[model samples]
Each structure stands twice: as C-alpha cells, then as structure tokens.
Target: MSKSKFTTIGRKILMALSGFFLMFFLLQHLTINMLSVVSPDMFNDVSQFMGTNPVVQFALQPVLIFAVFFHFIMGIVLELQNRRARSIKYAYSKPGTNSSWISRNMIITGLVVLAFLGLHFYDFWVHEMTVKYGGGDMSGLINPNDLDSGYRYHEELVAKFVDPVRVIIYVISFVLLSLHLMHGFQSSFQSMGVSKGKNFIKKFGNVFAIAVPALFVFIAIYHHLQH
Candidate 1:
C-alpha cells in the first residue's frame, strides 16, 4: 500500500511517525557534530566510521533519505487536502484569527529546510561519497602518503563554514526550521492521539523545537568564528 493512498487519518499518523524518526536523527546528528567542537580527532573517527560502515551508509542512509522525502511529500498532500476541505472561501481575511503564521505556512518553512538539505548533502555527503568511492580513499587523510597529516574530516567541516554567506544561509534556514518544528512536533503528538498530558506535550515540543535548532545555529557560527 502506497502512502499516497492511505486514509487521511492514517496518513497523518504515519507522517507523525516519520517526523519523530527525523527528530531523533536530528538529535543524533547534532550530537556527532558537537564532537567536532570538543575534539577533532573524535569527530573524524566517528565520521570515518559512519562514512565507511555498511549498515549506516547502506541500510540507515537509504531509509533516512526515504523518510525525508516521504515527510515532505506527505506534508504537501495534507496541506492540499486541508485547503480542499475549506473549499468555501472566507471572504475577509483576519489572518491570526484562526491559525498562527507558523501553522499556516508549514509547507513554506519545510521548503526552505528541504533546500538547506540539498546544500548540506552537496557540502558533506556527496563529497564523502566522492572521496570514498570516486577517489578510492577511505583513509580520511589529506595525503595518503603521510600518516601524521591527520584526518581530513575536521578540516573539511571547518572549510565549509569559512564562507560568511553560507553561514548566514545556514542560520536563516535553521531559524525557519525551528518554526516548522515548533508546530510539527506538537501536531505530530496530536495526530498520533496521545492526548494524555496535552500541556506537557506542548511544552516539551516547544523546548525541543527551539533547543535543537539553536544548537545547530550555534555550531555553524562557532565553526565560522574558528576560522
């Protein structure tokens, strides 16, 4: 059964599931990235493992890619369906009277996040793939001839954030991501019918949404400052 064919409620539930998974992924990614700031060697070691390991590169990577696309596509379908359900237009627009801007423009924020992902993949994953396969080097070294040259992962990361314009784009994208997650996180719980402790859920969602993106922004700025 295709996700496109799932009942509206079923689709919402699955969408929420994927959202949760992505959230978990984001935390793990941030944790690994944080190591770059704490210890370059540790970060490089982890990156090498992730880049080389079959389970992560083959099994989890594909699933992660699928989930990203699935969540984005499902959001579009859900938004269109919601619009269709409100076929009769409300002539006068009192924007905030009904829904917050964050709620109303989830798709817009998501598009920005999606665009950032493209830039991110080109910066890291694509480069990693090229190095690991195209260049025939999985040593994570600058020069294969010298062992004391150290790993290339940390340097590559630093180089990417050296551009001021890129850092601005990254920060802006993360701000929008926070807005998207602010609504999506709580809504995911709502869609899944976990109505128990609704207030607590909303509070936790707010914190997660804000804190995660804030950390990402800090990382980007922190790296940029280092160079």
Candidate 2:
C-alpha cells in the first residue's frame, strides 16, 4: 500500500524512520568533516576510504539518497495535510502562546534547508563527480595544507568557504537546520514510541539539536578564516 494512504500516525512513523537514518548520516559526515580542522592526514585517509569503498559507494550512498527523497516528500505531504485540516485559523489565535517559532515554522525552515542542499550538491558533490567521472581537473586547485594528497577534495572543500558570501549562506543554513532539529530531534523519538514524556530524553534531544548544527557552523567559519 502507498505510504500516503497510511494513517497520520503511520506516515509520521515513516518520516521518523527516514529522519533517524539521515541523522546517522549526519553524524558520520560531520565526524569526517571535523577532522579537516584537527588532522588533515586523518581526514584524507578517511575520505579516500569513503570515496573508494565499494559498499559505501554502491549501497549506502543510494540508501541515503532515497532516505533524503522520501523524508522530504513525506514532510511536504504532511505539511499540506496539516494546512488542509486547519484551513480556518482560530479567530484569536496567539501562535507564540501555543508553540515556539521553530516548531511552528518547520516547513519554512525545511524549505531553506532544501535550497541549501541544492547549492551544497552543486558546490561539492556535482563538482566531485565531474572531476571523478568526467575527466575534469581536480588537481589544479591549490591544497590548503600544501601537501599533495593525490586528491583535491580537501582543497576544494577549503576553497568553497573562502568566499565570504558562501560562508554567510552556509552559516545561515546551519542556523535554520539547528532550528529544525530543535523540534525534529525530540519529535522523531516521540513518533517512534520511545523516549516519550521523559525529561532526560527531551533534554538530550535539545542538546543534540543545538550542538550538531553548531559544530557544522564552526567548521565553515574555521575553514573561511584558515584560508
């Protein structure tokens, strides 16, 4: 049966499952990215492995792509349904009194994140694929570490942040991402029928929401200043 035909709770469960998977990817990707700040050699070693590993390349990447697509489409569907169900706003509605801005504006923040994802793919993924498969020059770009790592991925990464405009946009994106997580992190756990109504669980989720995206913003700023 189509997931869209499922009950609201069921669709939320699907969204939660996809969200958790994406969070796993976020952790792995963030760990690798932060290495560029601490140890470029380590970053290069890990990057090469991830780039060359047949399992990661063939299996996990496709799964991640599907997860992203599924989660995004489901989110939009839910948003539309929510709007339809509440077509008439309360006459004296005080939105802030009921819900926080981040919670209320999830769809807006998600759209910003989606737009950033497109720019991000264009800046890195598309370029990487072009150089890898289309015989474009990857070696011409100057390496930040002054060492020939035989791959220009690290150099390309640093290059992207050197632009002030890109850095600002990246910072803004991460901020919105953090706001999205502020609501999503805990909500996912609640949907999965775990950690619901638990104070400690809620606290953990709140901390994760702020910390993860802050780390990403720091990475972008660090690279921009380093260059």
Q: Best-fitting candidate, measured by lDDT?
A: 1
Q: Give the winner by TM-score.
A: 1
TM-score of 2: 0.89
Identify the runs in model 1 with alpha carbons over 4 angstroms from their true place.
1-5, 86-88
RMSD of each: 2.2, 3.4
lDDT of each: 0.93, 0.84
**Candidate 1 per-residue C-alpha lDDT over 1-227 given as tens digits, one digit per residue, 9 for 90 to 100:** 65566788899999999999999999999999999999989999998899889999899999999999999998888889899898899888899998899988999999999999999999988988898899989788888779988889999999999999999999999999999999999999999999999899889989999999999999899999997
TM-score to native of every candidate shown: 0.94, 0.89
- Candidate 2: which stretches are off by over 4 Å? 1-5, 136-149, 195-197
Candidate 2 local accuracy as lDDT? 0.84
TM match of model 1 to true structure: 0.94
